[model samples]
Every structure is written in C-alpha cells, then in structure tokens.
Target: MTRYRTTDGKEDMKQKVHWFGAAAIPLAFMNGLFFGGYALRKIRQYWEGGPMD
Candidate 1:
C-alpha cells in the first residue's frame, strides 16, 4: 500500500526568506568558483594525458 499527499487549495503556500538565506548567495558563488577551478585543472590534465594525482 502506498500513501499519497494531497494539497488543498486553501493551504497557505507563502514563502519567506530569512536574513541568513541572503548570505548563502555569496557562499554558493565561492563554492562554484572553487569547484570550477578544480574541474578546469582536471580537464587540463586530461588533455595533456597526465595521470590525475
């Protein structure tokens, strides 16, 4: 047996962003930059046929 969730039209669906949520934008950006650089380095190594170390 499986249960399903149903939402009524009368349910409140408002969303609010707290002050801390705004701070995550910069953190997410920095994370993206860090990972992007790491990925680029790996890609360069692959192009050069070098071992991933």
Candidate 2:
C-alpha cells in the first residue's frame, strides 16, 4: 500500500498524528509512566526485529 505520493501528503501524516495522539497520550497516562514507556520501547524493538521473540 505504498502511496507513491505523487501529491503533497502532509495531511495524511497530520491525520495519523491526530488519531494516535488521541489514543496514546491519555492511555499512556492511565497506564502510568513506566509501563507506558516500556510498552513503547518494546513496540520499537519488535518493529526493528521482525516480530521475533
């Protein structure tokens, strides 16, 4: 689903920022800082590591 991006695509990025921003901020606060930070770290780890254990 590569966009090829023949047009200006800032709106798409902004849209995503808005969506995830809505969920991630308060959700992270609810979960507390340590767990929230660790979860984000693990997500980045998995992203780089091809989802392997």
Candidate 3:
C-alpha cells in the first residue's frame, strides 16, 4: 500500500472536502438510479424468468 502525503495538510484536506462535496450528490444520485434499475431487472428476472444477462 502507498501513502499519500501532502506538505500543506490543512489546505489539502480542505480541497479534498470541497471536491467530495461537489461530487457526492451526483454520484449518490447516479448510484441510486443504477442500483434501482438493476434491482428491478433482477426482480423481473426472478418473477418472469426473463433473460438478465
């Protein structure tokens, strides 16, 4: 495993927090949509014996 070290620790953390904040919402939404669709497809497959792959 590799460790990432930054000279400006506080600034680095702040920047990382900002990036995460900006990305979290869309990422969460997309993940939810993708998993929801996947679950629905799986349910359909289980009930109707539809092809899932």
Candidate 4:
C-alpha cells in the first residue's frame, strides 16, 4: 500500500481533529456529570429503601 502525502490533506485532518477535540472535551465532561449524578441519585434511593424511578 502506497500513501500519498499532501499538506492540504494533513491540514484538513488536523483541523477536523482539533474541532472534534474542542467539542468532545466539554461533551465528555457533561456525559460524566450526567452519569455521575444519575448514579448518586440511584444510590440515595437505594439507601432510603425507596422505589427506583
């Protein structure tokens, strides 16, 4: 397999990765927070011997 090198392609890929990282960082953080809160809520319910909603 032969791969061609081009500055344009490299720059495009870099830009895409940069954009993805910018979006992904906050998204990942929010996802963690959402799940963490959900877990805590479930834990509290279990500790209280209440029904899970």
* Cα lDDT tens digits for candidate 1, 1-53: 22333486453445455556677889899999999999999999999899767
lDDT for position 22 in model 1 = 76
The true-versus-predicted C-alpha distance at residue 34 of model 2, in Å, is 0.2
Off by over 4 Å in 2: 1-31, 50-53
| Stretches of candidate 4 exceeding 4 Å from the true structure | 1-17
- Model 2 local distance difference test score: 0.64
Q: What is the per-residue lDDT of model 4 for residues 11-41, given as tens digits with 9 covering 90 to 100?
A: 3223233466568879999999999999999
In order of lDDT, best first, we have 1, 3, 4, 2
Q: What is the lDDT of residue 21 in candidate 1?
A: 68
Cα lDDT computed for each candidate against the true fold? 0.75, 0.64, 0.73, 0.73
**Which 10 consecutive residues of model 3 have the lowest summed lDDT?**
9-18
Q: Residues 1-53, candidate 2: write the lDDT tens digits.
A: 12233376543333233566568878878789878788988998888986555
Q: Count the backbone clashes (under 3 Å) in each candidate.
A: 0, 0, 0, 0
Instruction: Identify the leading candidate in terms of lDDT.
Output: 1
How close is every model to the real structure, measured as TM-score? 0.55, 0.34, 0.60, 0.60
Candidate scoring better on lDDT of 2 and 3:
3
Which wins on TM-score, candidate 1 or candidate 2? 1
